[model samples]
Target: MSGDEKGPVLQFATFQSSVDEGFWHGLSSLKLNKLKTDETPISIMGFYTPCSNPHVSSHLTLLAESLPTEPSDGLPTATTHGNRNKCSVPGTLYNTNTLEGYQSLDKKGLLQAEGKKIWEDIRSGKAEEDSSVLLRFLVVSFADLKKFHFYYSIAFPAVVLDPPATLVDLRPASEWFTLEEAESVSACCNEWRMSSLTADVPFFLVCISSNSNATIRPLKDFKACQHEDQKILFAFYDPYHGPNNPGWPLRNYLAFISARWNINKVQFLCYRENRGFADLGLSLVGEALIQPSQAWQDEEHVPKVIGWELNKERKVSRRVDLSTSMDPTRMVVSAA
Candidate 1:
């Protein structure tokens, strides 16, 4: 439609996280056997897919398979190769020993710390090398083994744009592209998604020629498109299907674009899908205008972060009670 029709300031749909019971079981195994009393951040993974249903939103999910098969005690940890059904995003877990430790954690400071890593990657060109760096997240938890209750909080740290980005134009991909352009873009996107090498990659560039030919390239090849006369669209596998809003990943993606490319205006695609293939009806394409600030030039200063999964309008931590289902003694008694 139009920028005015969608709203001026761009709003993003936040991720709703879901944890499988097996995830807690795996954590318990690691804590008791391999990582006793260790407070160091452990590498983890989270999975999500493009929103396929109009009424439902996709979740950032944690399963037992998300954790490493072995501890990295001087040995390399083996990571899972995610498939199209669930693309893996890297994350970290900070398992505190006590409730006091978890409660005393500097939430704001932690978020900024993680956010700074992302900002550094953007400026250092590491995010371009491996675009998955933009989706990194952190989790702080107190796994009460005795009570089988886990108190935790998750943050998908996003670098704040001081002036915030303005939407110049926003609408469905079907409306934004002509018939030939849509077909070419969809074919290119399908090829990107089906490849084992690029299927898990979340960010990429789509170059469209005046003749409506489209090609998908890795984020690392962004520079290659500099001299091309084609229209370049920054695309990501959007996990949200909101009619007007993009997903959480766009926040850092914008920061990366503004910092790395110094491009104030951007064309982007929220590449959503239906049944594992590209769906132009559910996807969105838009142009955003951002202000590249002087603060970004300073290496030491990191922008403010704004991602904290909320609960009932409060930025409070959450607790999950798994005693009934996970406690062996309780389970045995219930069976009797």
Candidate 2:
């Protein structure tokens, strides 16, 4: 896809100021410390049902199912994490199709040689019981919130899926975990592309109404989840709860990450009558925004965003109306 179709993509490291700079440094420093990461063994991975995002679910499923038989493992190099003779999890998150925990400006060239066997086991469907599981780390989509700030800054603990946790109830009233203290990051939005308009468009905050994972309690006790010994953060959002204002649910999402580290939450425009979920930002990581151009206005690619409130049954709705947000003349996204 052309850059136009890609929209105003922000390299996670490409921050607007020193704030962005310090963020990357903290992440990088943590990765290199053997004392902090070696035993940590952070095997990050996540999955969403077809309903939350058909495109992404399809993309992830296709990759998982399309795995060619395990290829030969590349030999490990002399390089080690810091001066200690140990390796961290997967080397880098740079250029990973999914966002979160990645460094786009990485010039030293980090390679993921460790997870090849685990990756194969996962794809082959006979994942052996291992300490790190299948993925070396997590996989959150850019379409979720359109930026990496939140996954790190605001949604720190929510970033990874702890499959072993005693799943939290996903219902609105039942789905909030509070942090005693959490650092707040600036909400940043990237410029998006419009198929019909020549001027720059912006990213829309499309909230999630439902998802397949809703049934599981990945968040455990609602206070935190654990994959082994590590304490992880999680928040299950209600489709129709109050998200317009950053209340407990929204603040709780930030708190989950904040309890671990300072994370940056993002700001976005609600395209509809602003009736979408504002109760929590948990939906941001699961949202799908597919557009012919970066503008997210193409109808063909414009996904159906279905949601429901606690007081009512679930309903399907268009997250945005191209006719309202972009040039109506040729606003519809054609599949052709």
Candidate 3:
């Protein structure tokens, strides 16, 4: 099908960030922008515990908050490097409160619970029932996304797996499209398996949580670079325990990209760094700025790590320009 047929699929899915609604704003409220060029008619199952009062929708309202990001150096604080203290993620596209909400849910069993339901839905064909509750995915931007490729980042991979029979359907805070499921729905993932995705639209399913386990494994006989698209579809597993801080994790990310082939473009939105950008193979990097009107949790300056091939370097670039960097593209990657 063509744009004339399916209409123009959204160029970006901007999950909006707002504080007035507080933490549990529901998936619909997270949306920030919509392209008005083309028109298409659009329209959920039970993946969340229902709450009539938005004020007390879930544990987010009770446990999470839009904490501020702090300097890793120069600034001093008694706060430790964990979720128990104040924290926030960097980036204009982020919702600080929503991230806190997600972090809170990770502490609970919401992710695992929602993962099971999502798997059940895919197996039973009830995906539309809980569509509204499932978070909307858009091409807001991400680190290291390349032209003609679909780059994926699994910040928290637990929710994508079907939980053990003992933990089936626990009514988690939200449901999400899993890694395997994402492959199932994407034409770009033909290496993963056959596709069941609706043919015309692009997909970007994102989730962030404070959950980090050393035992985490993202391998399923599928690798990020193995996309049928033959462009560059890289997937990263960021299990950083401390929020905002990027030293250990960012160093690891730089090292990880250094080992990969042709991955030169990188962008990051972390809050903390133990060393200067020079430590991460970045040079002459400038702060990527964002508008306060469009700011989620603005950082003083966003830096680009520059140089991935010459020095086997992985330099971060400016923010991802959704216009060309990301698309469901012609690359046909698939799922099981």
lDDT of each: 0.86, 0.22, 0.21
| Minimal lDDT window, size 10, model 1 | 73-82
Whole-model alpha-carbon lDDT for candidate 3: 0.21
Question: What's the lDDT of the predicted structure labeled candidate 1?
Answer: 0.86
In model 2, the Cα lDDT at residue 177 comes to 20
The list of candidate 3 runs beyond 4 A from truth reads: 1-112, 122-229, 232-336
What are the runs in model 1 whose C-alpha is more than 4 Å off? 1-7, 71-79, 313-315
Superior candidate under TM-score, 1 versus 2: 1
- Residue-by-residue lDDT tens digits, candidate 3, 194-216: 22231111111222222311111
TM-score for each candidate, following the candidate numbering: 0.94, 0.19, 0.17
Write one digit per residue (lDDT tens) for candidate 1, span 88-168: 887888899999999998888888888888988998999998888898888899999999999999889999897788888
lDDT of 3 at 147: 38
- Best of the candidates, lDDT: 1
Counted clashes in each candidate structure:
0, 19, 27
Positional deviation of residue 52's Cα in model 2 after best superposition, in angstroms: 25
